[model samples]
Target: MLKILPAKEIYLQGNEHAVLLLHSFTSHTRDMKKVATSLHAQGYTCYAPLYRGHGHTPEQLLHYQVDDWWQDVVDAHQFLLNEGYQKISVIGLSIGGIFTLKLAQFEKLSQIIVLSVPIDKEPAQLKQRIIDYAYNYKTIEGKSASQISQEMEPFHHMALDAMSAFQQFIQATMQQLDRITVPIAIYYGERDDASYAQSAETIYQHVHSSTKQKRGFENAKHLMTLGRDQDEIIQEIIDFLE
Candidate 1:
């Protein structure tokens, strides 16, 4: 067995400044743990919530849609407000970054930080990525090769409606990028796909924020938060947030 641990939400109490940390698609709250703990250490309260269809089986994930996950984002933000924190910042990765941008359009946030988010359009490999995630998830669950093959059969020919919804969601968010006016910092990994770099530039140019910045980590990849330069990235985030 791979000993894959269960994922849970992380909530660390610190000062009046609260940071909402959002994870990527098909990812867990644990992916944001290092960043959350580091922020907490710097006297910032942090909360990383596991989205509705995440931290569970891939099949179960397919059961939920983008709107459902968006609801999770809204609930997470409301949770912080209910805690009496007037100053709330957001740090989001990949899909979470999309949610961050969408939230910025409707909410008054202290600031925003997005890592490796796709902004131009729907990624060409979106469906393939989902298939890969399904395979890897089954492997982690201790399924044999044959069993995995059998289980993933349906996904290979799965409906495109779900994928279409995601594409529509991305397009919708991109259309509203100009509505985001909060101070924003965008980071992408140089080693990742070329599209991410383009996405970073697209976001920087479109957002109406007076204070906005974009940077690329030389040694980091798609998952920058858990990459080799994670510590450096965290320091940069701290600097920006401060």
Candidate 2:
């Protein structure tokens, strides 16, 4: 376990094939450890990296946006490449998954598996935002606006201009999908809050990779790999990489 200031480095067990695990927005690398463990137990070295402002405090991520994340993924790539690993595979959860695909649009990777990616940033897509505005500082029962404050904690007071940049990122990448020639697999939960119900299907239809797929699990939430039967999801990833 290596905490490199901005990026926490947790090396999974195996030393053979390497896989990089990037976590979601408003989250640290803690959860990816589950997938990393499975991959490592199967003899693949795994790198679970924490982003610049994530997994630290909500304030850390408030100012940072999606571009910051893309850079981190590339930094992780350089780190892994420097470690002498070839034929790398990347697996990411939620926003991390989108970052993985963003990287795939340009970088060369053995394969990329994206879970719960935000293909679009519709207001309906983020339930948290709706809840925040609807309640308007009102304390909630199941969860309060303050409880959900982490959603905007890092960028709370800012202008939220980060979204426009993310829009550009999506617009640029979606048009250049054909440029991504690597094997890509996407996994999403049927009950994901970040996506419209048909997100997985939409990705399958629009993405340009010849080797791509979409699999949605019943009752799986946005954090599908961390939900029930998470191991089975990791197994699907293992099979994909194998």
Candidate 3:
């Protein structure tokens, strides 16, 4: 396991109902901290696993496949099952949200909350954008490129091979969306640049869930959990889970 700095993995024991939080691609478990904490406070056991090849250097990420990350979630699910949690809900961000949808196909989940899931988008283009941003790392305020990259390393950049694996996962996940049968709460940022605004509607229209809800934030971006209206988003998740 890669030692993730600043924010380590979280596993808080609570009630029989458990919430599995998955962080975005290239993002560490820290990004899921607020959501996990909120769920844990509600007397629910919360487990946020650090996906394989994530929470480490970009170079390290290139060495792992997308299946490894998905298997990480599978392992976490089995762990929760072994712990005797009867109910399991999943909440994820971006690629994490995509993975959540994929897992819902096989796991008997209670509910799923997808935040800024990227559908109807080209993964290759997104990968190129990341490369562009990295090669042309800009100085923010007064911070140099090196300083900025260091500060944002945990959540930025994807190696070429990793991006290819990500694209494969995205394609397979999209094709299998109709397999989801549990209640779903889909949230997307209206002004999201990483994921198009229409992707949320596409998911809502395609999902087989009879109990589905959608929320759009006009001012928020892709990282809904870390955005300004995060409290509102978290409340929406909690309300949906109930």
Candidate 4:
């Protein structure tokens, strides 16, 4: 049986490395349970740290910024280290993927994976994708933008204090991509309008990591984690990790 742990406790697997599954922006750890379960079955202890502003109501997300999200990963990493798991792997989707890319370069983990990472939450050339993400985010299941925005407005944009931090997040990750020597995998959909594949392409090229792979689903969109393509995507992840 799968052992699910609360955010307050560390779930350890004796004699095994730990893997972290980080959820996307505005999502709770529940979103990662499937992926975490897959890794958990592979003899790895997996934990999904709830992003500060996410998993809660919209009111909670507005209070978060990228830095706050980074801190969550840092804490999770330390938690696993303290648990006696000397090796680690990290996998993240969307905004969580952004932090994973940032962490991969320096966390010195065993492996790293990103799924449609939110390299640009602003969705620059991918404006349509942002609209879709935001729209589906709140509008999904009949929730409206106003309803979601009212709750997410304060955090609708990068917090003022974290603008520089986000900038550095991009810069530092770029400069240190060559410093990363672990196995890295980039997963995304070819049809995704939310996150540009260029970001992943850049990583595949610049990162010094010798074992890096980028896999794409031709029919999948940005929410590659939860769509018809999920099976293929999950299988790809399993193959790559193994």
Candidate 5:
């Protein structure tokens, strides 16, 4: 029998300060594991929740709305709060970044870190891309069909309705960006495959946070958390949180 891989939540209990790290769309908590580990090393409690419809199949994502994902963050935040964590921060990657920004609108967070978020997205085009991918089951942009299939084997196909939900989430998040008052930090790569560095720069310029910073890595790609500057990125995050 083949060994089945489990999709488990990542949690580390440490100090009173808690950090919630969120993964990308179609990704599980594993994507944020390294960040959680680094934070744990710094004596910060960390939690990475598996969003609804994630960690199982990609097709399951189609059944979930942007609101469902946002609720996951809310529940995770509440979990920390229930554990007596008063000072909480968040780090979100890709669609997770969008959820983080949306969370800022409703929560009094200590800080916010956005990684590879799309601030200049063309929603219709993105939706169409998702539709095309679902229709053809094509290879991903940077991966072969087998590689893509292996990576997404646990997940189901992407659906058009889910893409529409994502578009709505993007619009909603953009509208609330100016309301974010916490100290904000954005990380981006100059050659990010999903979003441009200008999106990070744009967020730094627009968010109402008086203490905001933007960092760009010339060699890093979209997945900065797992890239060449991973250590540097973690150190920067630790420093910012401290």
Candidate 6:
């Protein structure tokens, strides 16, 4: 056993303005921890939920589908409502950004902030990333080269199915971008893939919100919150929310 510590959901209570922090796919809630804590310190209550089958072994992750993660996103929002948070803003990364758009279609949101969201579907790239995530997870678990190879043998087919479902979800969400009328801010790293910048532009052009803004950080990449410009990113988010 490599004794890797598992990630968990984060809930920090503050004032009435609630912020839902959503992490990227194949990532943990810890990815949103810094931003969550910063927001909490600024008197904004924050909740970051761990999606189903995440924060565990990659084999466990493969058992859950995209639909399951969407449900988790919904449940997390409802939880804040139950906690008496009337003014709710959502900040999401990657697939979490897609869920935010989907939620905006049916729910009332105060603000929407999305980072590194993918607008165009690249099935081959997405599948390869999923496979790479599995291999990385097994490596972290202290598996040998031969064992990891054998374990990953059965995951190719499953990865394909997962990728298909993910593409469908993205398409469905993209179709409803015009339904979102809340104040929206989109950010992408200049160093990230061009798809993210394109996604930001597409989202900005599609949303019906009058107060929409898009920006890119030069010192950042796919994971902006963890990038070199993290402090600047946090400050920008606070400025937007305020």
Top candidate, metric lDDT: 1
Task: Give Cα distance to truth, residue 224, candidate 3, Å.
Answer: 0.5
lDDT of 1 by residue, 1-242 (tens): 66666689999999999999999988889779999999999999999999986887778776787789899999999999999999999999999999999999999999999999987444446667778889998887888999999999877886777777888998899999999999999999999999999999999999999999999999999999999999999999999999
Q: Candidate 5 lDDT, tens digit per residue, 1-242?
A: 22325478899999989999999766678879999998998899999999887765335555676678888889999999999999999999988898899899889999999999986455556555444444344342345666766656433444455556678778778877899999988998776864557778778877999999999878778777888888888888888887
Model 4: residue 123 alpha-carbon error in angstroms: 8.9
- Candidate with more favorable, higher lDDT: 1 or 3: 1
- Overall local distance difference test of candidate 2: 0.72
Query: How would you encode candidate 2's per-residue C-alpha lDDT over 1-242 as one tens digit per residue?
Result: 22334446687647757899988766677769788888888889899877776655334555566777788889988888898987789998877877777778777889999888776764233334423432342232235455655554533445535666766776566566667778888888877764534656666777777888788877788777789859789889999998
| Span of ten consecutive residues with least summed lDDT in model 2 | 133-142
User: Which sequence of candidate numbers ranks them by lDDT, best first?
Assistant: 1, 6, 3, 5, 2, 4
User: Which has the higher TM-score value, candidate number 1 or candidate number 5?
Assistant: 1
TM-score of each: 0.96, 0.80, 0.84, 0.78, 0.84, 0.96
Q: Which residue pairs come into collision in candidate 1?
A: none
Worst 10 residues of 4 by lDDT: 1-10
Q: After best superposition, candidate 2 residue 208: deviation in angstroms?
A: 3.7
Q: What TM-score does candidate 5 get on C-alpha atoms? A: 0.84
Candidate 5 wrong stretches, greater than 4 Å = 1-4, 120-159
lDDT of every model, 2 decimals: 0.91, 0.72, 0.80, 0.69, 0.79, 0.90
Give me the displacement of residue 81 in model 3, in angstroms.
Answer: 0.7
lDDT of 4: 0.69
Query: What are the candidates' C-alpha RMSDs?
Result: 1.4, 5.5, 4.7, 5.4, 4.6, 1.2
Per-residue alpha-carbon lDDT of model 6 for 133-183, expressed as tens digits? 889988988999999999997667664767787888899899889999999
Q: How many backbone clashes does candidate 1 have?
A: 0
Give me the displacement of residue 223 in model 1, in angstroms. Answer: 0.3
Quantify how close model 1 is to the true structure by its C-alpha RMSD in Å: 1.4
lDDT of 6: 0.90
lDDT of 5: 0.79
